[model samples]
Target: MDIATLYNANINNITTAKNAFDVLATTFGKATEAWQHEIADRLTAEHWTGTTATSAGTQIKNLGSELQAAHQELSFVSKALADAAEGFAAAQAHLISALDDAKNAKLNVAPDGRLTWDNESTSPNFAGTDAEATAKEISKRITAALNEADHADQAIEQRLSHLAYNASSGTGLDAATVKQDQAAVAARDQVPATGTDPDGVKRWWDGLTEAQQQRFILNHPDQVGNLDGVPAIARDQANRINLQRSKQDLQLQLDHLGPEPAHTVKAGRGSVENADYSAWRTKHDDLQEKLHSINDIESRLAGDKLKFRDNTPAFLLGFDTKGKGRAIVSVNNPDTADNVVTFVPGTTSRFGTASGDVDKADEMARAAKQADSTKTTATIAWVGYDAPQSILPEAAYESWAQNAEKDLARFQIGLRSTHEGTPSHNVLMGHSYGSTTVGYTMRDHNLPVDDVVLVGSPGVGVDHAKDLNIDPSHVYVARGGDDIGIAIAAGTLNFGLDPTWDSFGAKHLPAGNSDHNHYWVKDSPSVRAFGEVAAGTWRL
Candidate 1:
């Protein structure tokens, strides 16, 4: 068979199918258009005869059916074209195979009908050379190594699965989904104190005394699986011994373990470990402080914004203050140009939200002012607009971002008017949706600001810091490990607001802790980085 001719036939079939589909689609389109025109004409008829109307209605119905059928036929033709193309490729492959077989054919004429090849000389006929022996040894070693490796890998996988099951079954913490975790913990706890360790449990049994091991095994009879190649007598004895020991240890722990603290609310669906008490206290204290400070802050929001005067230039009253919202004007020519910091809050972000009972927005400003208080810098909480109440009913991120942009623009314009002659450097700080606002302002509004500090950011809504239309070197980001929002904000696609701008190919300040809407305070990694930036050292 001619391969080219066979391929041509297949190609012709596909082309014909495709052409048929196209023609059907065109016909359907034209028929629909004509039917619509005919319907319009029939509606406008002056001689409303019943027969004439019926014929026109019949024509419309028939045309509609024809169009539907054409659409269906086009779909069939398209599928047929695809099938024909595949068939053509298969035919091409078969033709090539047949041609190859015909060229390489070997006819047998011997009485026994045995087949032979002219290229038989090339076949290996090893006669025990040193190289051949060495090759064979290498091959044998390689096979053994591969087998060992596969076994090791499979063993590890099986052991890990067992461990997962044991961990999932942990005592006193088992929920419906975590039974396997309980099992995992039980497996570890039930380990036999066999002086000869279980195969994969050497790590867990390392430091137990023989007596303790024997006791642990005694109490956990049901936990034993295979004895990991140990002698049957020894393994059974070890399991009995270890189980008894575990019972004693658990009883001793229970006796000493104090009752849960009155205010110790659980963090998640897990047992409170020994170290969590301190964490619980710290959070509790922080929350209390937040509650106490908010009321004091709400009283301060009613007045007009303030400014100060210092004698670096002989009673210069107004210096470097151009923007909307309240301003924290620094008096003297402090070492750093950025002697003032402005916070632009996002949607629904107001004075009361930061703390349960206190005006947290104002409290943060006061804390910032008190933090670095030689008049070197001051902080302003710019709640320029009434933020959206809730994200669900009305305040979506995008909608708030748009609202923030408008207000931030007005605020920036107002600030520019305030500091028309003053020349102090400026820093714009934002959080969560506020970061979006800041990013949009810098990129879209072209606000003249020095540095932008973003904490607990979801995303700046820009691809990179440079894309925010600001000086890339001045953008800073921070995220804490325990932050609930970080999971959703840390990825490129999800925009979980990861602070990995430096590693993710953008210039930014050192990342700090910004988890669950809480910015890290003094002594925190993020706070230290913020201090560095506030002091005008951008490299941190």
Candidate 2:
């Protein structure tokens, strides 16, 4: 089968469906509104003296209700079809762009799925100046274009099939119906599952055209942001776009609530309007907090230097405003770094507290550079899980750690997949409850990391370093002298044995006389040792 031909046909069908649904939606929508306001209301008001007249009124009311429901269903289908059409069109455009690039590069594809460079051009062209180099470049471009086209063709078919199913089965504009439609769309287009091979994801992502990448990022930001094996740069791009969209959506919701009443109390407390106002205010405040967090990241990126880096740029690797909020930011391009460190924060972590976490990551990056100025190091603040919000019993339990393990493991896989050259000396550093999350992830899944550092850790969900699936020599721990709470809870509220203890069979680092939060501070021994570990220069 010719993939290009198949894609073209699907694009045409989508366009036809979009136009047809639009017409039905507009016609039926107007008729339904007219029947309800003009005919149904009048029929209800009539003083029917005869039984036949009353019966006719009842039938008319029922018909009006049916028409209203039909109109709503039609409207929903129309929008769905329109969105599908737009997505198809974008996919088609990207495919065409890729084809154009292939053509410009003088690459030819045979029906048998093989690419060849047309070096013997009859027409005068820029072919022979650097024939070998040009041929290699053309081969690469054609390969990428073909891969993108193939993926796009498959995606379009799946989406169209799902849309057809929904158009036939969906009944009304209820929440369930809407949710079903959304789930169908997501299932069709979401990134590969967590269990998918990281290498496969890397190959697929590397082959996509820039336009195709942008399309996925805009259409399915959440999936792209969390997708294992996606490049940090691409994830960052998608998450930032998603962040902006979320803020806009929230603002629109606030605007729809209309202007606040003048007579309402100043704080909108203890009044009839208070509840509604308070709800909206809370949403608004959350939106602002996220916006502020994003702005802070942007400001750091704009600066000439971020900690140790002189010109390296910062990026937002992941983001979410749902729940308590989660974010992952990289202080440098991890893809090309010789060393990389991912830091996970502990309790009460949220987007509102991201600025400080990000600062600490920057400090880590700087310290890593100081440890070995010749090696490139990237440090990421990975608040990519819903960490416990409080120190309550529920939060202190191991269930939260279990729930977070898969996500953390997937994130580490993503880092490995996107690396450009030889694998970096990757390190996982966790503090407090964050250590529990890392421990569970390492023990449950095969995380591609070189070193593990647990600081102010309660326990690592295991009695010994052997259970962590890493070399005991590579497992490091640091506990501040003042972190009495963590020391006391080591065998109680903690998951299992404390890594810093001699019985845990892990290397212990000097942490200095500081508290839980000061481990990463400048001039701290703990921070310096962490830097050395991340740089692969530390010794026992």
| lDDT by residue (tens digit), candidate 2, 254-348 | 56766653444555456444666677677767766776776776667665345334656788887777778888889888988999999999888
- Per-residue C-alpha lDDT of model 1 across residues 313-377, encoded as one tens digit per residue: 11111111112211112222222323545566654554334222112233333343444544354
Clashes of each: 58, 0
TM value for model 2:
0.62
Stretches of model 1 off by over 4 angstroms after superposition? 1-295, 298-338, 346-348, 354-375, 386-388, 391-396, 420-422, 489-514
For this target, which candidate reaches the highest TM-score against the unseen true structure? 2
What is residue 401's positional error in candidate 2, in angstroms? 0.6
Segments of candidate 2 deviating more than 4 angstroms: 1-197, 251-285, 303-309
lDDT of 2 at 387: 86
